[model samples]
Target: MASNVAQFAEGEDPQQMSSDTAALQDQGWALDTDGMGVTKTFHFKSYFKAVAFVNLIAAESSAKKHHPTMTMRIGSVDVHWTTHRPRGLTHKDIDLARHCDRGAGLMGAVESGQGIKCGPKN
Candidate 1:
């Protein structure tokens, strides 16, 4: 099931954030306390793998024209997505967040707290 099956219109009301956040939560994304963005951290076994995953995220961001704020660690990456133009979350951010999760899975990256059991490729 695609996490971003829903689309939001420009200037959508904040009321929709509840449902949008719920869908993202199921996919491992956490909403910021301010309710303005969603974040997720991906873990890898090596720095090289982490960098490779970041590259995939970059490509996706560029393709969608919706960039995210990223923090790279030795073997992990934190991705925070928010639509800045209108200053809140949007369908684009949700869709890109889902893509990030899918891309991370394909590259053998796992969520930060999931450890080895969550490694989809293993």
Candidate 2:
């Protein structure tokens, strides 16, 4: 809903949205119970990698003019994509979610168990 994004762009149709959301869900993204957005948590080997991933996302979002809500941690980042203007999921959301998957891979994202955690060691 930023001035940079197209004001006329709208959310996807239910049918098309189903398939689009499904693909992201298979990649670990979860559809919001309210059916308005999608979320995923990407893990990394170190704090540096995690921060790098966030930066990667930031660059892409800026270029696309569609930003996501990101919560960064020592070894992970939780990303939620939703079109505020459209008030639901849209093509931009789908595209950006896929970009996130690709970026995470490039950043050496790891499984939750394998990721570095900021806490006392066992």
Candidate 3:
């Protein structure tokens, strides 16, 4: 469920940030302690699944001209979103964060305890 998402034209607006990030938090996202970005970790059953989730986000990022810094682990992908041009969290970041969640689900993401360790379960 991709949406037409865009970045704000200015820096972080504290008043707007509160409401903007609250819902995401409920969905397992973390607002950066530095207050510059948001992050979430998605667990998967394999490294391939983890990488696939990154590619899914990449496609969405390319479509929106907005991207997140993603670190793919053996069985988890860490996604961090922020707008450097406007120097803060934007609607783009929020929207993409949600997209990451969707993509994770589509990739068959598992819970942290169920994640693949080396490659596959024996």
Candidate 4:
């Protein structure tokens, strides 16, 4: 989907980032308000399933060597992707976000389509 961005390079320029962000948004990801990352949350019926989804993402990130920050709760997992080297979102982040969508689907997670939400503070 989204014009076969499978081979997209990392650290794409600003215009390219905008295009990639639009495509990713169509797939249920949203750019963080701070303009540094993209994030989406997936919901599960059980804590075990949520953790399983996180595990799946962990394995994929490890294999790709592009890790994401994952937050797991009782029945959800939020995935955030950004490239630190270039100091902003990039094609790598978009691709990984797409991969996470597919991976979560395979694991039977119901994608929220609501972007991100912070947890309770200490």
Q: In terms of TM-score, which candidate is strongest?
A: 2
TM-score of each: 0.77, 0.87, 0.83, 0.76
Candidate 2 structure quality by residue, lDDT tens digits, 14-118: 777777777877788887656677888899999999989999999999999999999998888999888888677788888999999999999999998899987
- Model 2 weakest lDDT span, ten residues long: 1-10
Q: Better model by lDDT, 2 or 4?
A: 2
How much lDDT does candidate 1 score?
Answer: 0.77
Q: After superposition, how far is residue 94 of candidate 1 from its true place, in Å?
A: 0.3
**Candidate 3 lDDT, tens digit per residue, 4-78?**
232333755656756777788889887665556788889998788888888899999999999898888888888
Model 2 clash tally, residue pairs: 0
What is candidate 4's lDDT per residue for 1-122, written digit by digit as tens? 12222222354676777787878878877766556788888887667778778988888789889999888877788788877786777777887898888887877776564323346634
Output the worst ten-in-a-row residue range by lDDT, candidate 3. Answer: 1-10
Look at candidate 2 and tell me the lDDT of residue 99.
Answer: 95
Clashes of each: 0, 0, 0, 0
**Cα error, candidate 2, residue 82 (Å):** 0.3
Question: Judged by lDDT relative to the true structure, which candidate is superior, 1 or 3?
Answer: 3
Order of the predicted models by TM-score, top scorer first: 2, 3, 1, 4
Q: Name the candidate, 1 or 2, with the larger lDDT value.
A: 2
**Which residue pairs in candidate 2 have backbone atoms (N, alpha carbon, C) closer than 3 angstroms, thus clashing?**
none
Tell me model 2's lDDT, rounded to 2 decimals.
Answer: 0.83
State the local distance difference test value for candidate 3.
0.80
Per-candidate local distance difference test: 0.77, 0.83, 0.80, 0.74
